[model samples]
Target: MSIWISWMVAAGVVVILELFTGTFYLLMIAIGLVAGGLVALMGSGHELPYIVAGIVGVAATLALHRSKYGWKKNSDASQDPNVNMDIGQSITVKEWQDNGNGKFSARAMYRGALWDVELVAPAAAAGVFTIVEVQGSRLMVRA
Candidate 1:
């Protein structure tokens, strides 16, 4: 088989693998392989196609890595509503207990279980509170 045919076959295999992986990096390399195939079809010297493929693949991967999709915004799982389903849920704090560290806390019944609750600030003894953060089994609340 011709060198161009080999290049095209490699590109097709990479594209097939990219489908299962569901990431664009493999697709970029496949594009570079296609470039190599095109160069081979133009009757370039044997080494030039390999060099062009390597350069194009690396450049495409680097460009993708520098794009916005490459990075995700770091978020605290306890406070981010998307991470925790109970972050914005309201609960009733019938009383606040002084932990003696100048902080007030209470145990509140939530989601059919009693959860340890900590107040964000010193508030009145009894009122409805919104869950702001969840640290383990403890729910941090703000009035």
Candidate 2:
């Protein structure tokens, strides 16, 4: 019925939505709605509450934008498989095979599975290759 009650309800709804979104934007706006409610409680005009709410919301959102948690994560981290724990493990190349891509490949037993190993350069007979990077189940290595 009262303006303060309406602002409080809006803030409560935003807070509920923030739980599912996992973002700080909604929570910042909720802070603004709470500010509006407080202004309304102080017997201010209808316009003043709205203005206060807008200003508070903008300020809060900007604060969040500048914070570390607000920005998007680096996509490179997800694309590079070398970030994994088993990246630097070594594998033995019993023999080298032609990959048809102008690079040589081989089958190596790694992590309990026969993995496709990509050798950047020619490997020696019965050479051991240290895993430099992983691409899916395959490994990129140097002799």
lDDT for every model?
Answer: 0.91, 0.84
Q: Could you give candidate 2's per-residue lDDT for residues 46-113 as a string of tens digits?
A: 99989999999999999999898678676553235556765667788898877676678888888788
TM-score of 2: 0.65
Best by TM-score: 1
C-alpha RMSD of candidate 2: 4.3
Q: Taking the tens digit of each residue's C-alpha lDDT, what string does model 1 give over 32-53? A: 9999999999999999999999
Model 1: residues with Cα > 4 Å off, grouped in runs: 20-22, 71-76, 80-82, 121-126
Model 2 weakest 10-residue run by lDDT: 74-83
Q: What is the lDDT, from 0 to 100, of the residue 74 in candidate 1? A: 100
TM-scores, one per candidate: 0.74, 0.65
